[model samples]
Target chain A: MVNLAVKIKDLELKNPVMTASGTSGFGEELADFYDVDKLGAILLKGTTLRNRDGNPYPRMAETASGMLNAVGLQNKGIDYFIENIYPRIKDYNTPLIVNVNGSTIEEYIEVTQRVNELDKIPAIELNISCPNVKEGGMLFGTSCASAETVTREVRKAYSKTLIVKLSPNVTDIAEIARAVESEGADSVSLVNTFLGMAIDAEKRIPLLSTITGGLSGPAIKPIALRMVWQVSRAVKIPVIGMGGIMNATDAIEFFLAGATAIQVGTAIFRDPFTPLQIIDGLEDYLNRHQIDDICKLVGALKY
Target chain B: MPSNRIRMKKNVGEFTIVSNSALNNTNYHICLQSDIGLPDIAPGQFTNVDIPNNKDIFLRRPFSFFDVDYEKKTVSLLVKILGRGSKSLTELKVGSKLNLVYPLGRGFTIPDKNDKVLAVGGGSGVAPILQLAKTAGSSPGQMHIAIGARSAEDHISIADYLQFAQFYFTTEDGSLGEKGFVTDHPIFHDLTQYNRIYACGPLPMMKAIAARAKEAEIFCEVSLENLMACGFGVCLCCIEPTVKGNLCVCTDGPVFNIKDLKW
Candidate 1:
């Protein structure tokens, strides 16, 4: 059988297909439709040191190919996640990665410290690029200095794999990628949602309650691919690519572009079975190509 | 709960067109029979309608589970044809096979058997409120329903609701029961008469009702119509900010107690 196992630093995934953070809630909600063990990993919802009440009404807007969201990191704090959500997810076969968010460096440390205490969680995905929240979200991810600071502080408390999820809203994504790597980030995931807005011309009102939101879906796929390629080339750490990944072909494209693994986000809304389909498709591809291992495809780009 | 990823079995139900009539020159009332067994559906719950005519709007349109005939397994809807998406839904045949995602959002709270309930619906919002009245019809307590439309022609099926509720009608053009809005009618002048107030329809109308109910110390709940993509919670497109935080309207609610709402 073709080996689909992939290793990123200290962590190993059965396959390169993982669910993106925020899109997949703590790994419990998706269990109704599919087996959780079939996934390579599940990135939990974005969490902070303290519980946050996200933005006001109208947090989502629909676009042509995808949708926009201003969910504002509405999640139970890290403590609640450990006490309540973790106990449920820990029993699953897939690796659980907590996506951490904070408005300040100290908050990141506090969250990471709490998460480090958890026995089942294997990694902490520092969501330095969430566009919906007002404070620590896109703000920290936009600047290299802030990214470095948060990554460094979390690295101190957290001994597990630290993945810095970068944003595409910046001028140079490579610079931020390098900054997080320098600060001891174990891996990086590129292309969180892009800042976008839609308006109703006739009514003279914004379509979403927040007026503007983070755009995610097939519309942002090309941009996400380009960013992943750029960031993957810029850093030595493993790159987890995401944004608008809908099918098996898209997942394969991310692998060719140098991502060790790919995350399915917006596609889950359109078709719930997309992740399983991609996994099966990837297996077929490996067997067809006579490739004995799936890891051989990771960063297998030819210049 | 872990997110369910498998495609649930598509339940094919048939809805006979009880009465397909026009409303406000733009909207239509296309009621159908839900022959297949519909599980427990709540007030804020919605159904995903299969638009057979078009490929452009491949995704099903989510409408509140307006009303249910549990014994008959039938549900009804008030469709407002605003664009190509809704226009295609109105074209669906009465006996045609319709795919629906039923009981989606959390339904309104069931009133206590001894308490009085008031349901206010305006525009297309009257559908769910009518459904709520039918759901709470068996209660020993009294139920009142107030419906507001722009004109006489804007009104739809009232015969069904009349049997279950103290129905009140309002039309802005003085063509119906009363010559004013539902808020203008004497029935709503004193909100304290009702133990709980439920409203849906236009945003401004619901807001106004909520404000009045809050002042009269009555518990109020409104079903919000935020733009939604997936009726399930995955898209994160139907979130409403509240004191408790940003919650998915599709999951946490299309129904929210006024106290939790920021507005």
Candidate 2:
């Protein structure tokens, strides 16, 4: 049997497949589609200190190979996740990681502190790199000092495994990954949606509520793979790779390049059963390659 | 709430188009039939029609339940050619298969037996309102439907719903039954008679009806046509800020009482 298990510091994932935050809001939406526990881990939607109204309507626009969304982190705050969402998903066998976001360092710490109290939650993905939000999302992720400060502060209160999801809208992603890693970030996932936008020529207006949005789907997959490869080489910690990963073959590319784990986003919207299918496909791929343990596939790329 | 949901099952079902014909200058009537029997659909519920063979339009387009023939295993959509997806849906040939996420979102509240209901449909909004009036089982006198379009040629033939509702028509150019908007019709002069007001259409049209419904103190529900990608609740793209909170237009409702809406 090919073992699909992977480790992010103290936490152990059954496989290397996890759901990207914002795409999977809690575990209930896709609960009807498949057994969500079959996933390596569930990265819950980005939660903040207080409830956010998010951006205005017509928030999404479809483009070739991908779509743009300026959903603006519309969650019911950290308290709500602890009270309402945590109870419902706590029973699931898969690891539930809460992706925490905020406008400032304390706001980030507040969300991290609250999630740390939840016993079932094994990790917190510090979202210093959401491109859609106007303030404190990609703002924290764009710079080295801010990324380090947010990571260092949250790391102090939160003793569990910490994952900093990185933004791709930067000149040097490797530098930012190194910055967060220096601040005791257990691991880093790159790249979050690349900052992108679409416009309606006839209407002379931007397609999204926020003119620019994080572009995910097959459109960003190549760029994400490149960043993951770079960040994985730069940082000593495990690098979770995501971006435009649609199926099993695409996922194997991430493992080959150097990602310890991978998160399935945007594609899940099209097919909720993709994660399980990807997990199954990984097993088949490993068996086909005659690799007994999946770890052998990590960074196994030759030239 | 899951225990009491009207829809027993929801999925990506492959349905063959029995007919896809232009009903008017701007809209097309596409009827799809699935071999695997159709699910029970409530009014205001919609189908996310995947525009086949188009990589440009990656997301499925959300179309309200225009009509349904359960015994025939068919569901209908009133697609207005506004964007690439809707335009692509019109181009599909008969016998072409289209995948749809069926019975999506919360349908309208089934009105009381004795309640007098007025269903106002404007633009593509005519579909869901007509669906409700046709299958509502309300007596002819109790089911009042008013449909409005820019011009007479823009209105689709309503022969199918003739036996179901007491119909009214309006066009901006005055080529049809009336010369003004649906609200301008004499039928809406006295809103006190309508026990419930159900509307689905352009924002301005529904907002106008919402105001009148408020004045008359009649219970009103409006279906929103928010830009949606994923029909299921996965993507929070279709969120409508309501009294309860920021609820998904695809899940919490495509149908919501005027009271629950922030609009």
**Residue A222: error of model 2 in Å?**
1.2
Top model number, lDDT = 2
Tens-digit lDDT track for model 1 on A1-303? 888788877888998889888777776666755677899999988899898877765776667777788878878798888888788779999899999999988888899999888877888899999888767888999999888988888888999889999999999999999999999999999889999998989999997767889999888999999888898889999999998888888888899898989999877665555787899999998888898887688778788
lDDT of 1 by residue, B1-263 (tens): 11221143222243556555565566677767654455666666787665665645535577886666677767767788767777877776656666555557787997766779888898888888877877776332488888898898878767766767888889999899898878888888777778999999888888888889888989999999777665666656577778876777877888999999988
Would you list the C-alpha lDDT of every candidate in the order shown? 0.80, 0.88
True contacts kept of each: 0.31, 0.59
Report lDDT (Cα) of residue A12, candidate 1.
81
How far does residue A22 in candidate 2 sit from its true spot (Å)? 0.1
Considering the two chains of model 1, state its CAPRI-style docking category.
acceptable
State the lDDT of candidate 2 residue by residue for A90-136, as single tens digits: 99999999999999899999888888888999999999898888789
- Candidate 2: list runs displaced more than 4 Å: B1-9
